[model samples]
Target: MITLYGSPLSGNTHKVRMALAFLGLPWDERLTDAAARQSDAFAALTPMRQIPLFVDGGLTLRDSQAILAYLAARYRPGDWDGHTPEERSAIALWLSHAANEIANGPAALRLARRFGLAIPEDHAAAVTARFLPVIEAHLERRDWLAGDRLTIADLAASPYLALMEDAGIDPADWPAIHGWTRRIAALPAFPAIPGWPGEGAN
Candidate 1:
């Protein structure tokens, strides 16, 4: 069985967990606090001291997005994976956007608020204002981000947006994103991650 190291509350960690559940893979979770990530043992797995490290069959992988892609490739294969050249590129694009714009914007603002980090209200408001509309626009027509079918891209992006409540961003304002969340929430075998109540909670 695979072992996942991270706290349940982490959005990045939740992405990997979502992927594992979506693929129907059984994994043992080793919950760790933020300080534990800096320990020597954990440091060896991720030099940057990040959470959501994956230990599987003698291989250790870090970075939540990278781990999700690795698991999808190693386990699901074929169209389930965005393995074709075009599919891979498209998946990569979504993952990059998630990590860069989404993470740095809404996710960061939400984390700052939830954890009582020293982020100015103006900064958080600015991030939420910019990111919410972008997400709303993209989700306007697509059921999923990368391919016609659900892929790692959806799993990668879900947790952060789902936690928008922490940043005081109302999903009610974006019907497209709200509908997309509902679609994702209905996925079979979807596991409930910490910080997000099950479907229809908000």
Candidate 2:
């Protein structure tokens, strides 16, 4: 069985949870204890002490994007991932955007609002102002982020972007993004991300 360690409300953790649910994999969820995360046992797994630590047999993985990629590679194979080199690269590019822009933008805004972090509002807004339109324009022409099918890209990027409203960004301003969230929400086995609920795959 798979074992996932993280907080339920974490967007990073939600990515892993969504991938596992999509693959129909049964896994155990272990809530992280910030204090325990400093222990030697946890340090042995990941020196970063990052949450959303994934354990599958002997494999221990950190980083939400890496965890999602591993799940697709091991379970869905060529199906959930892309088919060609270009397609795979396209997916990877979006995954990078997820780790960078999305994380610094919407996700950071969230940390400031929900968790009382010290993130700068202007910096987060600047990041969102710059990248969100790119996503909006990209989604304006395509249903999915990369290629023509569902890939790790969508799973990696959607969680935080879907929380635009909570991040002080208006969702209605980006109709395409709103529609995209609904489409992803409609994916099979898509799990609700705490405050964000799912309408299930149509």
Candidate 3:
């Protein structure tokens, strides 16, 4: 059985859950959070103690992007995994962007706004201002993030990007980015990011 350890409301965790849904794989989820990570049991599982941890049989994985890549390549094969060398590199680039830019930009802002996290609001705003347009401009030339079809890259990036409003930014300001997220939402197997823009997307 595949077991995912993370909080459902967490965008990082939610992305992994979305990948599992799209793969049409039935799995169990263990609710984990910041406090839960402090437990000795959790620490024994992963020294990193990060949420969005995936356990399939004996293999234990941390980080949402890594988990998504493993799921795509392992279970579904060519369905979501990149087909070409260039496509794989492109997907890797977006995965890095998700871990750095998207995580620090909108995701940090949402944490600060909703949970009063100590992140500097101004810095996060600057990051978002810089990050959103690049995606908008890039999507103007392509339908998906990597290759000609949907891949784990889109799944890795879209959750936090969809939460622009939660970070005090307007989705209307970036039509291409907005449309891209809506397209993900329209996917038959896409799971909604609860309370975010993708929640009731058509």
Candidate 4:
């Protein structure tokens, strides 16, 4: 059995939840906050005290990117990670984008606006402005981010971008992105991100 630790509304946590769904893995979660993370039980699990923490058997992992990569490697193997060096490299690139650009841009925007986290709105907005166009143009001609087929790379990048609304950015501005998220949501067993467009309307 797999165990995940994080908040239900967190985009990062949602990424792992989606992966578990796609992989048909049974998992349970412990919702966390600063209080929960600082507690002895959570500290004994991971000193990092950050989420989404993943525990499978005796193995424990932190950081969503690391967890996503591990899930693909251990469970999906060549299927989700990729088949060739080029494909793997491309997937890695997108994962990095998801962790950095997507996280800093749209995700941070959500943190600031929705949760009032004191993040710099101007900086995040600038990053978001640049990010949306790059992704919009890239996705204009492609269905998936990394390769011709679906992979964890696609999963890695979609959450924050799809949750652009929570960032105060209109999803209608990027039709391709909207369509891409819709495609991802339509996949079998894909879990819903709390505020994604058309969520629960399916």
TM-score of 2: 0.93
- Pick the lDDT winner: 4
What order do you get sorting by TM-score, best first?
Answer: 4, 3, 2, 1
lDDT-based ranking, best first?
4, 2, 3, 1
lDDT tens digits, residue span 1-202, model 4: 8889989888888889999998898999888986998899888988888889999888999888889899899898888998899989989999988988898899999999889899878998888888789889999999999777778888889988888888888888889999899888888897866787654442
151-194: candidate 2 lDDT, tens digit per residue = 88998999887877677777879888888888888887888776
Which scores better on TM-score, 1 or 3? 3
Worst 10 residues of 4 by lDDT: 193-202
CA lDDT, candidate 2, residue 78: 74
Worst 10 residues of 1 by lDDT: 193-202
Error of 1 at 142 (Å): 1.7
Off by over 4 Å in 3: 198-202
Error of 2 at 13 (Å): 0.5
lDDT of each: 0.79, 0.86, 0.86, 0.87
Please count the clashing residue pairs in each candidate, in the order shown.
Answer: 0, 1, 0, 0
